[model samples]
Target: MLKNAALQYYHTVCSPNISSLLELRQSRKSNFEGREHQKYMLVKWNEISPNTILKKIESNDVELALSTLVINLRNIRMNLSPEFHAEKILYAKLLQACRTHPAWTIACSTINEEDTAALINSLRSNVATWKAQNKPTIEQFPRRDLDDSEILFIDPRYFNSNSN
Candidate 1:
């Protein structure tokens, strides 16, 4: 009952009026603290309702500029070590960061198969979380009909009027 109530409150009350200004600020500041840091924006610019925050960026807060954003993102990616293992973005970001930093890539490559397996599992779970939080209506299935080589992005041309 408590869980249900909290979820309801999150979906309704907390979903609209309040944006995570503190989180945004913290993420921004952290990114700015390090030259190697990546850009981090909890609420995307285009997703921000028309006039609210974009205006700040446009007004030369300067901190909100695209260059600053890139910094925050890089920092976030590089600093992504999770306490819990089931976070895919952390792995993705680490992998990305490692790609740019040869030393990091060498460290990642030296890990044994067991540790690699665990990290991959955590990352896959994180991907699921991202999909669910970003697109609530999309259904996730345990098995996919498409094999690794058969994957393609959905396009209008792929649809058939009379076919299932």
Candidate 2:
């Protein structure tokens, strides 16, 4: 059952269409090119609270959330709104948490079996690097759980035109 789930996630992330950004553009249509998907992302990002995002990650929808995030990041251009910036920052934190998650690590390894050992090693190295960068914040990731205590919510106010 676990293997099956991991394989499904792998296919979802690494499938031909998903693996290619061009395919993402062609199929999603609204990704990076159209405002439709961007609008959808904006609505969903706002509708879903931080706690809900954590719940989604805990429920193993990390890939979906991460994919939507990548799409949103690519979609917005020129001006970055506070909502958009908040969405990006929040999703990025969720993604980092998911990547370092124990179960997620195993699933990722299964997906990249062609380079399983290397990938796992790389993940560990990356975790160490994130730890060095984040200090105390990094300690919460290894426990393999997402909850209110562990979430890092970013303030939308932090977004500034000058920063971009």
Candidate 3:
């Protein structure tokens, strides 16, 4: 019964919002495009909707299917743009709610730890590279009033030799 509620929350709320974000990201040029593993993850995430999970449940591999979905959802959340901060926070809360449910442990156990760690490392590396490449230049920062003047901006205390 508890599992059903979690699944319902995922199907009705989490999936649609996540899918829309993923679709929007897909339509644009993405960092994921440069890496084969990321591209594979993107494709897998797009393929495994809540409806697909429902079908998988009929095959008696529900635990593995749910585990994959959760992992994919985590990856999608990690890749979401900063513009979606509110949505990301909401998803994090929702994911927390799902995780609190007892059924989550059962689903989680079906996932391979080594693969999950590798996937996480790859995603982290991708994010780090993207941040490095797209970081704001010094010129992009807002200039302070002192920056516009040629006068030295040192503190007055630095000239007080008598204090020592």
The numbered model that scores best in TM-score is: 3
Worst ten in a row by lDDT for model 1: 42-51
lDDT of 2 by residue, 1-50 (tens): 22574456446754644766676547444333356645655665444432
Better of 2 and 3 by TM-score: 3
Model 2 misplaced regions, further than 4 Å: 1-32, 59-164
- Measured against the true structure, the TM-scores of the candidates, in listed sequence, are 0.21, 0.22, 0.25
Per-prediction CA RMSD (Å): 23.1, 25.4, 21.2
Rank ordering of all candidates by TM-score, starting from the highest: 3, 2, 1
Candidate 1 overall Cα lDDT vs. reference?
Answer: 0.43
Per-residue lDDT value at 143 in model 3: 73
What tens-digit string does per-residue lDDT give for candidate 3 at 8-91? 655665556655757645533342333554556556545655446656666534345445555656666555544423544434
Q: For candidate 1, give the lDDT of residue 17.
A: 51
Query: What TM-score does candidate 3 get on C-alpha atoms?
Result: 0.25
